[model samples]
Target: MGWLKDDVALITGGGAGLGLALVHRFIDEGASVVVLERDANRADSLKRKFGEKIETVVGDVTSYEDNVKAVETAVERFGRLDTFVANAGVFDFFKPLSEFEGPEISAAFDELLSINVKGGLLGARAALDALIKSKGSMIFTVSNAGFYTGGGGPLYTASKHGLVGVVRQLAHELGPKVRVNGVAPGGMRTSLSGLKATNTADESLETMEGFEELIIGITPLRMSPTPDQYCGPYVLLASRENAAPMTGVVINTDGGLGVRGIMNVCGGEDLSA
Candidate 1:
């Protein structure tokens, strides 16, 4: 049997990208999953692809009611929730702070924070009762941006950092029953839609030159990770037997951003500078 056999998992944004990858991995490991995707089409797609093995919920993570309904649906369908993966998130597409005026920046900050930080927090809260009853775990999808400065612009970085705080705080408060943690992925290609900012995932290679340069130049491994590779850490965290003692842990699946090239003095310059 696989690590998560018979486990019931709730994965937000499971219709695509890292979320989709995690769904496939979890199911292959013999786990049942509920996909909470905002896009109705994506939810339908998951139903088609995974058949009855997966449950699809059309909801937004930012809404408390939606999160509530999602967790409830998971319990109703699977009888219990063994794990909750708060993987629904979007990038701010490096919309530099300088580009936005006072009002624009305020609007942008609110939008990003609402979707990224609030959504994860709501997911955790929604799953609290079920998780405590099952003694389950919560795993969030933080970005390399959560730890470092260059992964994204101001709003995104701030949101991720805030999420790290959420994971740690929840881990501290709900210990011994509900394990809380996060995974900080570096860069991967994915479809992240439904955001006010520019869509980073759908951008072309030529459009991502600056982004690629920023990532590859500093990563010690010098290779961007795939969305699928990042799912392993989540699976490990989700498995009670494997990561029982790990709480408040933030795994860096970010291609070694910790041990990498130097940062420039001129307001933190890039590789070529």
Candidate 2:
């Protein structure tokens, strides 16, 4: 549906998982994309896959300079930037507070928060002027952990919760010119991994055994969606015509995670005709 026809977007961490999915969705919806990825190989792969329809910038989201470069690339290549999607993130692999040593906790917290939270802040700031000029939108990728417990351990949960606040405050702060919103999607098998400081950098989310079953069993919808299934909200938020009334909103794409039953996780398990 060319919801974003002629629009231009910059997506951080757009080399894999949800980020890669967003890149595909945005382009399919008729938007030109610029991806900021830290991995050189991933950048090369994106270039090969999409050709001139997309631009790949080898950069990290946590660095202000890198964020600026990506934003600049979007503006320079596409003439304007209509959307800035801050989607780069890392996980903590459900390691609870008790599992962490005091020093390790400090180090891991700093690393994870810097990527999951600070990265968004920096990207928004870097794109602030361009977004205002075009009256564009900013879509942040949060998680079910943003609103409820059990989605992740303390570190991951806290980071997502922080994005919820960022969405609200930025929407308020950038009003009348730029729109700010977010998406809180449920479990998806992604390359999302834990912090190096936590010794779980090599552990991707998809490697978590029973993860698919866990999502299917817990949500009221009784299904685990993939990254592509989660791109609609981002597209809506990015669309100037369709989402004109949206701002300071965070769509919960977690298959009714908010309505989970206390006893069974899904109350409709015994539904009868």
lDDT per model vs. reference? 0.84, 0.93
Per-residue lDDT of 1-273 in model 1, one digit per residue for the tens?
499999999999898888999999999888999989988998999999999888988988889999999899889999999999998887777778877766767766777788888998898899999999999999989988889886778988999999899999999999988999999998875665424643344453334546565556567666666678888888899888999899999999887778764652222444443
Q: Return the TM-score for candidate 2, rounded to 2 decimals.
A: 0.97
Lowest summed lDDT across 10 adjacent residues in model 1 is found at: 264-273
Model 1 scores a C-alpha lDDT of 0.84
Candidate 2 residue-wise lDDT at 235: 95
- State which candidate has the highest TM-score: 2
Candidate 2: RMSD to truth: 1.4
